[model samples]
Target: MTTSTLILPGSPEWLRYFSASKVAALPIKLDERGEYTRGVSRWESPFSLFHRMAGHLEPEDPKDEFTVGHAAELMLAALYRELHPGWRLSPGEVQYVRTDLGVPAMATLDRRASRGSSRRVVEFKTARDANEFGVDGTDEIPADYFIQQTWQMGVTGYTRHPAHLMLGMSFFARRLFEVAFDAEVFAFLLEAARKFNAMLAEGIEPELDDTKPTYETIRELHPDIDGTAVYIEAADAQALLDSEADLDAAKSFAMGRKSWALKQMGNAQYLYVRDPGGDHKKDVKVADRRKNSHGSVSFYVNKKADLAAITGGIS
Candidate 1:
């Protein structure tokens, strides 16, 4: 889903991080220590950028990019309105999006202690569509996404579920596919978060533990879970079919549970952070370029794990 590195230019992680925060109307809560935790401080998501260009209604001979983009956005906004009644969004927030993840992280989630309150996180994604662009169709999120979503849950202590995965999607020709939250995926994420947090406390950052059958155990124990994390599927796939609607019908292509595509606006628009040869940027890293870029909020890396490896920033 949003976690995939298949995005146009930036790392898949960077793209998803920024896109979700930008489109979301609500503000992301600061980390436990009050450090800002949102991803990407600039640029609209590819889908969001195009969607805005399409506007409320379609224009004759609309840019295919804008039409498609607008349709996707309109549908999602409408879906959010339907699913989260109290949830709010601010359209202009995209103007100042940032992804500092707070030098080092202000705080990390604690796995052992019981967490209180409902926590939520969102991620965004767009693919080549069913129209065919190599081998791009996927109904499932990459394993990394599960970990990333879970990390948010772990970090924020939302719902006491350990983690939650909110998947959003917009395929070129196919309607958007949205899956609000996958409990199973969250469980895996929670475990990962739990382990990662534990490692952080111990001055370590847990890597994908090949020693354990990571996902298998999670799947087996999923039904036994009862956490409060709330996942709102932003799309109503059935709406498009039953209403005989157009692309304006919002559905989430990102989340697997829902499917929607804006009716083709002739003028769909698409954009990239680097509009025609812009400067390049890199993810927050663990100092020495010789080492892998680990322990960053974008990757839910542990604070103390790579403390020595880090030349700058603090958690």
Candidate 2:
């Protein structure tokens, strides 16, 4: 979608859901970044810095969405190949699955039904810890995660043998999986969707009690989205996980540092910030210091000079 026709062009509306991004950036769990970023444009205090730091406490990669989601999707495609070996993998599946929602994370897919001729509805476990699955082959799937994929199946109108699979297994050691259908899951999806739609109507995104809402919360609320927590057990699963883990770890480490990018917006030539390791860096924005040198994890935009290019160049 183009930026010109957006309902909430939050990239420029920095004053509504305002906060400071001058210290460390803390990504809000909800879709409030638009509102928050707009607000951050005018603040002038340490609190602004603090809020910015907190909002960007996690990593924000400079890579585009396709670059990021494509890697995960590619993994899923490979998993489908392993499970059904040459069983005509549908590009339509990608189109349907790429289906995301305006609410973000609550995406839906227009998939084929899992009824008579359908084998099962498979899901992938890109990230599974060591002790998640059972050893003796008793099929141990995390109920919450199972609910999510099952919910999607329910949304796609599948009633027969619905299963959630993992692409990676034998703990994080391996990375692939398969599954059979369950009726209990489909019923759960219907109820969850009913409630989730209501929350969206109220402009309320589901968030945890202690910490702010993360994207996980957004996906879980979808009634048609039962969760999946399967083990990763493919032959190449561990290798795949190792390769991706390094990338993910770097992103995770970068989050707190990126929050400090907000301080660059200030007119203060000498900006102070709390570095990711929790150390204060008085010389962070000094002259001749290249950006990546300090290892930033946030999107750096000058409120005065760079706000236009920050988001969609809204206002």
How many backbone overlaps does candidate 1 show?
48
Model 1 alpha-carbon drift over 4 Å, by segment: 1-75, 89-103, 106-118, 130-139, 160-315
**lDDT of model 1, residue 176:** 25
**What is candidate 1's lDDT per residue for 131-222, written digit by digit as tens?**
21122233244433434444444333343332322223533232222224455644543333233334334554112222123334334335
Q: After superposition, how far is residue 150 of candidate 2 from its true place, in Å?
A: 0.9
TM-score of each: 0.25, 0.36
Q: Identify the leading candidate in terms of lDDT.
A: 2
lDDT of each: 0.32, 0.37
Q: Relative to the unseen true structure, what is the C-alpha lDDT of residue 151 in candidate 2, on a scale of 0 to 100?
A: 49
- RMSD of candidates 1 onward, in order: 26.3, 22.2
- How well does candidate 2 score on lDDT at residue 40? 12
